[model samples]
Target: MENTSCCIYTFSPYIFLNAYGGLHGGAVAAVAEMVSIACARTVVSKDKDLFLGELSMSYLFAAPRNAEVIVDASVVRSGRNVTAVTVEFRLGESGGVVYTAKATFYNMPVASL
Candidate 1:
C-alpha cells in the first residue's frame, strides 16, 4: 500500500449557507482535488507536468462549523503514466467525514501544453 498524506485546512463562516452550513460543494471539491494532487505527487514517479484526468466525489454529510477541516488521500493504483487516488475530508476534532472523492492523474508531456 502506498503511503498516505494528510492536510488540514481552516474553514470559515462564509464557507456555508443554508441550514446545513459549512463548506459549500465547490469548496469541498477544491479541497478534495488538492488532496488528490498531493496523493499523486507522493505516489506517482513522474514529474509535475501530470494533469488531473477525472474526479468523482460523494458528499456524505454536512461539515462541522468554525473548525479545522482535514483531508487525506491514499493511493489506490499507480502506473507509469496514470495514478488513481482516493481522498476524504472530515472535521478535525470529531473526524466525521464530510466528503469523499476519487481522482485519476495522467502524465502529460510538456510539449502538449
Candidate 2:
C-alpha cells in the first residue's frame, strides 16, 4: 500500500559473507524476489492470481559488511495478463549498485463457472 506501481524498501540485512569475503548471492536474490513480489502486487489486481514466472538476478560488485542496502523495485510494465518488475540493490554509503534483478509475474484471471 505504499506506492501505486513502485516500492522502495531500505534495510540492512546481516551480511552473509561468501568464502571470498563478499556478500552472498543467495541473500541478494532472496531479497530481490521479496521486493519484486511486493512491487508486482501494487500493479496487479486483488481479484487476479499473481505468480512469479521468471526472475533474473545479477551481481555487480562485492558489498562490504555492515553496509546498508537500499532496494528499489518498480513495475516496468503492467499488461492485461502480465506484469514486469525491476529491482536494484545499492549501497547506502557509496551508492553503488551491488545487485540487480528483474521479475516477471503472470496474472491469471479468475475461472468462470
Predictions: Cα RMSD each: 3.0, 2.8
lDDT of 2: 0.85
lDDT of 1 by residue, 1-113 (tens): 46455444555544454466656788778878887787677665554476889999998887756767777788888777778888877777888887889998896655645
Q: Write the per-residue lDDT of candidate 2 for residues 7-79, one digit (tens) a residue.
A: 7788765658898877889988888999999888877888999889999998889787777888899888889
**Predicted structure 2, TM vs. truth:** 0.89
lDDT of each: 0.74, 0.85
Q: Score every model by TM-score.
A: 0.76, 0.89
In the predicted model 2, the residue pairs found to clash are: none
Model 2 regions more than 4 Å off: 1-5
User: Residue 48 in model 1: shift from native, Å?
Assistant: 5.8
